[model samples]
Target: MVDQVTSILKEYSVHTDNKMNEIVESRKRVGHLYDMMKYHLGWMDENFNLSRASGGKQLRSTMCLLSCEAISGDFNKALPAAAGLELIHNFSLIHDDIEDGDEKRRHRDTLWKVWGVPQAINTGDAMDVIANIAILSLEDTVKPKVLVSIMKVFNDMVIRLCEGQYLDMDFQTREEVTVDEYIEMISGKTAALIEASTGIGAMIATEDADIIDRFKTFGFKIGIAFQIQDDILGIWGDPATTGKSAKNDIRNKKKSLPVLYAMQTSAEKEELKNLYRKETLTEDDISRIYDILTAAGSLEYTQSMANRYKDEAMSRLEGLYPGSEPMKKLHEIGKFLVERDY
Candidate 1:
């Protein structure tokens, strides 16, 4: 599945390159600031030396480009929008890591950890400005009306992303977070940008409201499912491959779907609550939490929900493109995200 996603992304390597090049060029006046952003993007080292590591999955950008290509004949025209979406995603990640007190991302120290919180906050703020600029760059490639529509959608997504993040932070202390509430939080926090990506892609490629609506639905469902999959991985994934500690979320006592499910259904709810209230968790606590999660069928329930969303995303794509390669690739990507191990 990793290779499959890599193959699909290969078709749009230039878009990624152009996006990075633009980011680099956009920061010529502030070399230090650029270095901070570059390091966070996995493009350079702390000393400003270039690195060969690929930045990220670039999943949202790929979906945007794919939606454009599926509707029209090319995705290059939507490069700026794709870049903007990627920037927004990374911006949120920078803030999220700070909020969560995470130390690592992609196997390296997070920006706030390496550069201090104030600088990291400023860098994230700058990235938000640059992301808006990137979207406006679409003015050169798309019609004025289309650019206006895309910007409006992008703005709404940004607001929803903030609301989702707030809900997520609030959930950390709120013991009564239900499954439905978790869904709403993730829909805003994780899925809103993806929804914008595909929607803007289709909007750029065509003017058909129905098609754009379908694409938005596709992105939203898959985005939610992908987060649920990550929650499952957070508890049970192989730390070696996942670049995270086993039961990472358990140690943090995050209100992920699996934990919430266990809280609701496990016979050990009182024990789980008592454990979660501690300031620190030992490996023994994590293991016991895992046992409680498993005994409550949390893992199975989360997987079932992921599958349900992926299935619905695929269903929405049906007849939208018939047998086109882009449509097929979108379906494949949705499946891969939900089913991937690492």
Candidate 2:
């Protein structure tokens, strides 16, 4: 299953990256703006020279294409939308780096850090515009009504992503953030794009509303689980694997699921709160917080929640296309999301 998922990711990544590159290179003559976009995408170096750095897993785009193939057996029809999904995801990442004040992504200096915030914001905005334009490439392939529908879904996803980002930033400043609130924030910030990825792919493949809804729901659940896994990694992941500091979330005081759960349930909740309140946390402070969270079973609780969502996501595929290879691959991908270390 891992090998199958890897093959699917590699196959679709090449397709999606090629499509994205074509879209961006169409305007390469426009100068450093496009270069900045390419840099963030890992296609170019900070100095505008070409380089092949890791961008990410390209999971959303792969899911988009895979969902389309699972339904219609013709993933080619969804290529533009898949590329658009990836570009928009990167757009969010660019802005997110600025918003979070993150210096590095994928072990390299973040776009904001390299080019400064102002130009990075402009580059992100341009990338977003290009993402919209990328989807417009589908106009010649799909019917006008279908194109309009896809546009609506795509735009709604962008709006939700922004709202999620707003809530995430807002939460950072607040003293208390409930688990429910965190879920709501991530639904918009993280899950909306994933939902749209699968939903739009299904839309491109078929006109069946029921199947589309199921795919969207599957995406939403998988996305939730994906974020939970990320939250888990944020604290416990190996820095060599995750490309971030150990206990990075605690260092940043991110009110992730485990921390919130520990705060609510741990006997050491007050001490945890006090530690978080400190302007700076030492190595000892981070270790103590880890102990408190572990003692409260926060990691176990978070992992269970992630698995629950993943299981639900897998359930959505049952009876849709029984025994289909693509359907099986989707299930594998869902499992991988919760189980991935980075």
Candidate 3:
């Protein structure tokens, strides 16, 4: 069903682009700025090849569509919200790579890497503006009162995203990050958009208060599980699916879930502390940190926590809607979010 959803999402992606032009298009005057937005969307690239990695997976858009249908609402009514999440997510990614000094995104050079940080920052800002514009299309698709309420929800989520990013950047230098802190950070940085994707989709579909809360709780829990799983894979999962080895996160001094778990457990917190305290971490030190993190069972611990969240999410989902094909797809995809290496 995820594959089927992905199929619909690709169709929606093209359609969303066409709809966006209705708002963003001006003559050749602002073409360069428009092209920058397109470039980040994988419509244009530095090498000028259309070929790119699976551009964003469109998972959020697909979720919006599915939830809309499942909740007994018209799927087309949710298109603006679907496109909104996609733009919001891509905006976050563009800035995330720039802030992390990451050179690659989806198997291609990140905008910051190819174009430089200053322009990359501007480009991400532009994408965010586009995201806001995308949501306004709801004015046409939804009732006026409903549109205002949903737009407020979308705006609030974006603010939370910034808070998450703020904490993530702060974690870089902080020596005493906890597992709890990691959860909060990901909730803002990674989970907010995801939660909104599912929640807003439900809003477009149904007016039941209980059902909306169900979708919110479900998306929130799954989002945490997804990031924890990603962090674990970043440290110990296979490289082919993850694009980063089990050792990559440590090499970058990332304060991910497992790393935080290991930090407080070891009597040698001092040792772990010293390794990360260095100005420049060597390749050799990264190997040693991985060994310590492994010995501390950080990967296993993180995986266990992911399972707990997935269970919680599934339970909430079970209450909202009964067993059905779409629900099964949601269940499968939700579990896969945590269990899969990629």
Q: Pick the candidate with the highest TM-score.
A: 2
**Over all chains combined, what TM-score does candidate 3 have?**
0.90
In model 2, which regions exceed 4 Å deviation? 1-3
Tens digit of per-residue lDDT, candidate 2, span 97-176: 99888898987999989989999999999999999999999997799999999999999999999999999989878888
Q: What is the C-alpha lDDT of each candidate?
A: 0.88, 0.92, 0.78
Model 3 pairs whose backbones collide = 235-246
State how far residue 192 of model 1 sits from its true place (Å). Answer: 0.8
Candidate 2 weakest ten by summed lDDT? 22-31
Per lDDT, what order, best first?
2, 1, 3
Worst 10 residues of 3 by lDDT: 22-31
Candidate 3 lDDT at 62 equals 67
- TM-scores of the candidates are 0.95, 0.96, 0.90
Q: Write the per-residue lDDT of candidate 1 for residues 1-342, one digit (tens) a residue.
A: 678878887767557657856865766677488788888888887777998555788889999999999999798888988888888888999999999898988878899999999999999998888889889988888899989999999999999999999998899888688899999999999889889989999999999999999999999999999999999899899999887788888988888999998888899998998888888999899899889999999999999999999888777888887889888888888888898888
Q: Give the count of colliding residue pairs in each prediction.
A: 0, 0, 1
lDDT of candidate 3 over 1-342, digit per residue (tens): 446545555755665555545545532546366666666777777654553444677777767666776787357777777777888898999998987888888777888877788988887888788788888778876787877878888988999999999999998868788888888899998888878888888888777889888887888899889888888888887888676755777877888988888888976677988998998788788888888888888877898899999999888887555765556556766877887766
Cα RMSD to the true fold for all candidates:
1.6, 1.4, 2.6
